[model samples]
Target: MMVANEDVQVAPTRGRPATLSADGIVDVALKLLDAHPKDELSMAKIARELSVSPPALYRYFPTRTSLLNAMSAAVFADFPEMPADRSWREQLLAWQNDVAAVYERHHGVMMLMGWDDQLAGPWLKVQMPVLTLLHSIGFSRLSLVETTSWFLAATVGLIRTYLAADSDGLSRSDLIEFSEGLGGLTDAQRMLVEETREWISRGDPARILNLGFEALVDGVERRLGSLQAKGHI
Candidate 1:
């Protein structure tokens, strides 16, 4: 679920001048992000929202990317550690769901970070925990980088694609037609129907996203089986 936007921030000192600490700045910046839609957020907008000079805002975050990194860090700081009691597949799916929730809230934050190659630390904080869980689970057919890339492509890539399309309004009819047009495919209708069933059951960004999650978990199980057969785990 999406979080409600809160009141505009002031210096937290109560009566006297509230110090514009990094945390406070981040608080206000996050507010601005929530209040505005994608591409509408900027340093100027944030400064105006906070009633601070743009240069004053720049003092802490030298560039817009830097401030965004801080915002991403602040968001990631809340992600829970991996659940030790759960199986590795369970833990990894749960972590990806949590990451998806955060990315949904922030919308384009990750894309912005990608644009500048910024905030490697917080970004890795999300990736490493899951990768470590996979490693602990004995997944080694693909290198960590390869597995991580594939997982992100499924989860984050799906989210970005949905957002870009304004909720993946692409009709499954088209998909089914395309599959039928692929020539001699015996199970084309069944395959496309099964794939699009979740989408048909509900709406974009959640139903389809859950399907992607299941696919990732299935991939992990397959990799685990392969490793076990080879005595690699």
Candidate 2:
């Protein structure tokens, strides 16, 4: 199952053909997941799709969990890194854009984020620097742990808000329908959602990410000052 070009702006024009080996089995599984959810996928299904017996697959994956672990490791193994000298906000904006670009380029890879330990561990290791960067910049004004949590919510919140949006991003009209149908939003609340949606739709998704991330950092700056003044950092 190739990633549809329409779904991701960066989906590759072609894929490397896999030979029926350990890497090959994992590669095919990754492709197959583009169409099916994780729970619905199994080695037997993969074997059938590959026109090989299930036992033949054992030479590669050994077990389903191991295959997933391998997949997780592969996704993060060569993920990009930021340069050493940029300011914190610049580095973080780059970090957010980098992850978004990675997900767009690899297609279904981000879905593995919900998998168990094997998937979670390596993924976090790759992305942890973003959190550490925030902590380093915020310093005593914000506890590293709490600041990291807020950063996660802010970044992930922005990503999740429109990750499903396509190349053009979401439209104000789309959000209008949602706001109207999903009643109980006061006019002020509805207006806020509409404005946020419009801001997101203004350009490529990276623009929305930048705006949201900067707003988050600005809020952090404010809170940090308040905490310091109150002797609570």
Candidate 3:
């Protein structure tokens, strides 16, 4: 997961306001991400939002990729520093929650996190902190690395799935209509759907994410116990 600070704006100061800095550009870009979807975000659109010419943005970002990298960095800037005193499970849960919140706020970036070179720095920075916590909790170095990777991949995949499921453009109504025509599901099935939808309406992503993390940790603890019993360490 790409973790960064909330987008910070270039503040107007006593001196002439700084020309569009990387920070300024990222601030506008984040706004644009919220205003528009990932498919719609563009350098030209960001320049327009910032009230600057495209060339002016180029002086700071150089290319669209560079701007994206900056935006990715800014997203991670808000991540809470890893706590030294917390138990490893507590630390991991906190980190996962923080990443999930970041992904929710910048849902557009979920798409980029899987592909962008911009994520590399934050990924590297976070890896050791996470591994150290896992190791401290009795994970072997290899186990720590593998577990961390699995957890991250699973969380990111879940976020992407959640976003895709909630997207308005997909039209769940159409699916219902199609199913109705096919006599696909009985009335009982349709009613179950209504109940499920109602439950979903009240569900919070943060709560759901925490629940998932707990389940994962439970499973890992069981396996770790087995490994220790076998004297694998």
Candidate 4:
């Protein structure tokens, strides 16, 4: 997400001032985060980039947790609203694509996905659209919460596995050697294993994510139909 540089006039100084706003800190922090994992990123690095002391940052964000929370908020600041013109299923897929796009664009976001108690506002902003859609289709209370949780959990797991598999750089020779090591498989098991191996070696993360989403939608539809039949909605 691009942070706009608002035209705020400030007095000239020999060096950067400690009065740097929280937005300014978050902006620099995000740039650093893109190149460095959260565990390796230090406040001193941000301070150096801003031409200020590390202690100065605490004036705005008293702790590292607070600063990380602010960074998370900025990462999702311009989250797209689900389109009003699409069918509900289409809208849900669009939302999943948009959310996945954010994760793909900002590699650092994977680390920032941990929910922070201080970030309820930003979390709700990111989640409420999909949650409301599920609610509209007869999911309620505990089921509503569980369904949303399942979708997000599945999405995150798929992306993580996809990236790891993509980096494997497995070759035909590698797969052949690996396959030869496995013995005692029935013909059917062998076929299934080879197909899965081939798919995982070259599968598109987004396509797999969409397929999982479609499956979830189908399950939800079936549940809603059953509830309607039983007069539960």
Candidate 5:
């Protein structure tokens, strides 16, 4: 179930100034992330930046890991609401592109997405919409779960790779050239390099995400069809 916008409220802290809400803390953290890479942004640093005592920061975050988990949830919440009229593939691509943009804007959060604890809250909110899409497309319950899991993994993996590469300040063209220079390239490898260059030149994240997502969807659909033909669905 996609969380209703009303249900996504940050817990209100008592006795704090109106400006000292969790949302305000997340805003500060995002600014810090934009200024520093993931490994460099610390809870102490955020506290110092906000001019709050470290213990005061603990009143909200409790620990560095908890703070990071909150940050990850914030990232997911920042995604633009999906368009209702788009196809499932289109919706998924849009969602992935939105996530990629957020990761690009706050490169620090990319590192946290890999940790299971950090990802839990966002995953709960994410999987339902994806599962609903799969169900609408005629996927069985078990297959819907499996396929959505794979899609999330792939989308996050791609975003992680993209952010890590961006942090190094390597242009997309540079990455393509580097990939092409590797020895023993298979035809598929060359094609990927070419496609990557095109995607980069166009500055089209949607195209890149959609291409990868569509391939995954195609595989899932084919498998589902086969299973259904065998009376599995």
Candidate 6:
């Protein structure tokens, strides 16, 4: 279900100053969230950023989840509309790149999303276009729903996994030092690690993410081909 654009943002409370408006709180929270881990961006931290007490923030957001949902709205508010002229495949690739850019920019914002489905505006903003394209290509209602779910899961999973890996993966020096310790391994195990060391140690996150996404789209295309062979369309 797509949440309306307005439904994701926090509404202003009466009596708050413009500087302490709902949008203001969301903006500060997003900035703090980007700089810190999701769990660290508490209401108190946001309040400190704004030079106010936690209670003052509660007047607008009321709870940390509300503020996080509003921040999500702010992040996705500028999600671009898909180009009308592209083929379905072209649009799917373009959409994957664009969505990757957002997740890359915000880093860990996915974890901050509200659990309540009512706050799903950011999700649908990125999801609905692909689902619509698949539907246009003759995916049945059940297939459409199932395929869209898999598409979302795969896209988000690859991006999140790579982002974490890119940041937390060993440094070059660390990798070299760790390689020394691998002498204790069996001959076959050591040979495998030596053969794949560079690839594993320096996985190009963007390239891997794009490849994973493209592979997913390729599966969708193959499924379309199978259905066409049966004259299902």
Sort the candidates on TM-score, descending order. Answer: 6, 3, 4, 2, 5, 1
Candidate 4 clashes between residue pairs 3 or more apart in a chain or in different chains: none
Residue-wise lDDT of candidate 3 within 1-233, one digit each (tens)? 22222233443234333676778778888766754553466666676687755556666766666666677677776678777687767777777777667766765655344344535465456556766776777878777667777777776666556545235332222234333443677799878866676566566755765787777666667767877898875
Per-candidate clashes come to 0, 0, 8, 0, 0, 0
| C-alpha lDDT values of all predictions | 0.63, 0.61, 0.63, 0.68, 0.64, 0.68
Instruction: Please report how far candidate 5 places residue 177 from its true position, in Å.
Output: 5.4
Instruction: Please give the distance, in angstroms, between residue 165's alpha carbon in candidate 3 and its true position after superposition.
Output: 9.5
Q: Which candidate's TM-score is highest? A: 6
TM-score of each: 0.66, 0.68, 0.72, 0.70, 0.67, 0.77
Count of clashes in candidate 4: 0
- What would the per-residue lDDT of candidate 2 be over residues 128-227, giving only the tens digit for each residue? 8866675666554436667667876676656655564222332222333454544787888888877777664456655656787788767667766776
- For residues 24-116, what per-residue lDDT tens digits would candidate 6 score against the true structure? 878777666665543455665666688766667877776656666677778887877777699887788788777777766776467544455
Q: Listing every candidate in turn, what is its Cα RMSD in Å to the true structure after a full C-alpha superposition?
A: 8.1, 8.6, 6.9, 7.4, 7.9, 6.3
Residue ranges of candidate 2 with Cα displaced over 4 Å: 1-18, 37-39, 117-119, 138-142, 165-203
Q: Which pairs of residues clash in candidate 6, taking residues 3 or more apart in a chain or in different chains?
A: none
